[model samples]
Target: MEVAQFIIQILNGLSYGLLLFLLAAGLSLIFGLMGIINLAHGSYYMLGAYLGLTIMKTSANFILALVGAATLVALLGLIMERVFFRGLYKQELDQVLLTFGFIYIFMDLAKYLWGGTPRSLPTPPLLEGSLEIFGAAFPVYRLALIVSGLAVALLLRLFLEKTRTGMIIRAGVDDKEMVTALAINIKLYFSIIFALGAFLAAFGGVMGGPVIGAYPGLDFEILVLALAVVVVGGLGTLRGAFWGSILVGFIDTFSKALFPSFSMLTIYIAMALILILKPSGLLGRMELS
Candidate 1:
C-alpha cells in the first residue's frame, strides 16, 4: 500500500472511530449512571437512519432530518424509561429481557415501515465534494463527520465537567441515594440521561447514514460494535470511549483491509489481548456502584 492509501485508511478509521465514540459514549454513560445494559440501544440508531432518510426525502433538509430524528428518538427513550425501564432498575435479568424484546419489536417495525430494502442517506449538497489528501481525493463529507464528532466530544466534556447539571450527574453517579437525600430530583436526571443517550445514538445514525446506509440487521452489528467499545474502553468514562473507539476503529479497519473474511475475528482477538493486559480498560476507573 502506498503512503497516500495508508493515510486515507487512517482517515477512514478515524471517521468510523469517532462515530463509534459518540454511539458508545451514550451507552457507557447510561450504564455507568443507571446500571442499565440496554440491549435495544442500537435500535435508536436504526430508527434514526430510517426516520432521517424519510425526513430528508420529504423536506430535503439535512439539518431538519438530524434534529427531527434525534428528537423523536429522545422522546421514545423517555417513554421507554417511564413506561418500562423505570421499574427494572438494578434488575439485570429483567432489563436484559425487556430491552431484548424491544430489539425484535423494533426490527419488525423497521421491516414493516421501511421494508427490507437497504437505503442510504444522500450527502447534503453543501457537503458534496472531496478534498485532496496525500494526493488522494478523500470525501469532504467524511472529514466533516470527523470534525462534527470532535466538536460534540468537546461540548460533552464541557457539559459533564463544567455545568451544574453535570456536577450533579457526576455526584449522582457516585451516590444516587445521597444525591437524592440532598433533595435533588435525581429521578428526573435519570430520565434526562436516558433520553440523552437515545438522542446521541440517533445523531450518530443520521450522520453515518451516508457512509453505512440504512439496512436490516445493522442494529445488531452496531450493538456488537458499541458493546465492544464499552468492554474495551471500560464501563463509563468518556476518555475510555474516545481512546477505545480509535483503537478499535483502527484495528477493525486495517484488519478488514488485510483479511476481509476474518475482520471480526481479528477484532475479537485484539480485544482478548487487551483484556488480558488490563481488565478494567486503559483509563477506566472502578465501576460506579
Candidate 2:
C-alpha cells in the first residue's frame, strides 16, 4: 500500500479504537464499581443512536440532537438502575438473564417505533470534510471522534483520581464492604456509576451513528464486541479497556486493510490468545468481596 494509504488506515484504526474505548469504558466502569454485568448496555447505545436520529430529524440541529439523545438515555439508565438493577446485583445469573431479555425488548421497541430499516444521521456541518495531515486526507469527523474520546478518557481519569466522588468510587472498587462500613452510601455510588456508564455508551452510539448507519441488529453486534473487550482488557479495569480497545481496533482494522481474508477472525484470535496467556486480563484486579 502507498504511504498515504497506510497513514489513512492508521487514522481509521485510531478513530475506531477511540469509538471502542468510548463504549467499553462505560462497561468497564460499571463492572468495576458495581460488579453488575449489564447485558443491556448495548441497548442503551442503540437508544442513543435512535434518539439522536429522531432529534436531528425533528429539530434539524445536530448539536441539540446529541445533547437530547444523551440526556434521554441517561435518564433511562437512572430509571433502570433504580427500578431493576439495584435488586439484581445479588443474583448475577439473573441479572445477566434479565438484561439479556431487556436487550430483545429494547431492540424490538426501537424497531416498532423506528421500523426495521437502517437509519443514517448527517454529520454536523462543522465536521463534514477531510483534513490534510502529513499529506494524507482524513475525515474530519473521525478526527473529532479521536479528540472527543481522548478528552473523555482524560476527564474520566481526573474525575476518578482528583474528585471526592471519584475517590469514593475508586475505594468502592478496591473494597466495597470496608467503604460501606465506613458509612459511605454505596447504593448511591452504584447508581451514579451505572448512570455514568450509560451516558458514555449512549454518547458513543450517538457519535458513531453518522459513520456506521443505525440498524436493528447493531446492538447485538456491538454487545459481542464490548464483551470481548471487557474480557480481554480484564474485568473492571479502565486503563485496560483503553489499551485493549486500541489493540483490538488496530488488529482488526490493520488486518482488514492488509489481509482481508482473515480479517474478521483476527479479533477473536487475539481475544483467545489473551485469555490463554493471562486469564485475569492485562489489568484486572481481584473483585472486591
Candidate 3:
C-alpha cells in the first residue's frame, strides 16, 4: 500500500479505537466495581443513536442531540438500577437475565418508534468536510471523534484521580464491604456509576452515528465489538480498556486493509493469543474466565 493510504488507515484505526474505548469504558467500570453483568448496555447505545438522530433531524443541532441523548440514557440507567437492579445485587444470574430481557424490550421499542429502516445523523457543518493529513484527505468528523474520545478519557482520569467522589469509587471497587462499613452510601455510589456508564455508552453512540449509522441491529453489532474490547483489555482497568481498544481497532482496520478475507478472523486470533500470553490482559487486574 502507498504511504498515504497506510497513514489514512492508521488514522481510521485510531478514530475507531477511540470510539471503542468510549463504549467499553463504562462496561469496564461497572463490571469491575459492581460485578454486575449488564447485558442491556448495548441497548443504551442504540437508544442514544436513535435519540440523537431524532434530535438532529428536528433541531439541526448536533451538540444538542449528543447532550440530549446522553442525558436521557443516563436517566434511564438510573431508573433501571434503582427499580430493577438494586434488589438483584450480587445475584449475577438474575442481573444477566433481567438485562437480557431489557435488550429485547429496547429493540422492540426502537423498532416501533423508528421503524426498521436505518438512520444516520448528519455531520455538523463545522466538521462536514475533510483535511489533508500526510497528503491524504481525512474526514473532519472522524478527527473530531478521536479528539473527543481522548478529551473524555483525560477528564475521566482527572475525575478519578483528583476528586473525592472518584476516590470513594476507587475505594469501593477495592473493597465494597469496607467502604460500606465506613458509612459511605455505597448504593448511591453504585447508582451514580451505573448512570455514568450509560451516559458514556450513549455519548459514544451519538459520536459514532455519523460513521456507523443508526440501524435496527446496530446495538448487537457494537455490543459484540464492545464486549470484545472489555474482555481483551482486562475487566477492571481503564488503562487496559484504552490500550485494548487501540489494539483491536488497529488489528481490525489493518487486517481489513491488508487481508480482506481474514479480517473477520484476525481480531479473534489476537484475543486468543492475548489470553494465552497474558490471561489478565495487558493492564487488567482481573482474571479471565
Candidate with best lDDT: 3
**In candidate 2, where is summed lDDT lowest over 10 consecutive residues?**
280-289
Lowest summed lDDT over 10 consecutive residues: which window, candidate 1? 280-289
Stronger candidate by lDDT (1 vs 3): 3
What residue pairs are clashing in model 2? none
Worst 10 residues of 3 by lDDT: 280-289
Per residue, candidate 3 scores C-alpha lDDT tens digits across 46-123 of: 999999999999999999999999999999999999999988877878987999999999999999999999888888
Q: What are the clashing pairs of model 1?
A: none
Alpha-carbon local distance difference test for all models: 0.89, 0.85, 0.89
Could you give me the TM-score of model 2 versus the true structure? 0.95
Query: Taking the tens digit of each residue's C-alpha lDDT, what string does model 1 give over 164-251?
Result: 9888888887788899999998878889888998999999999999999999999999999998887788877888888888888888
RMSD of each: 1.5, 1.7, 1.3
Candidate 2 lDDT for residue 53: 93
- In model 2, how large is the Cα lDDT of residue 33? 80
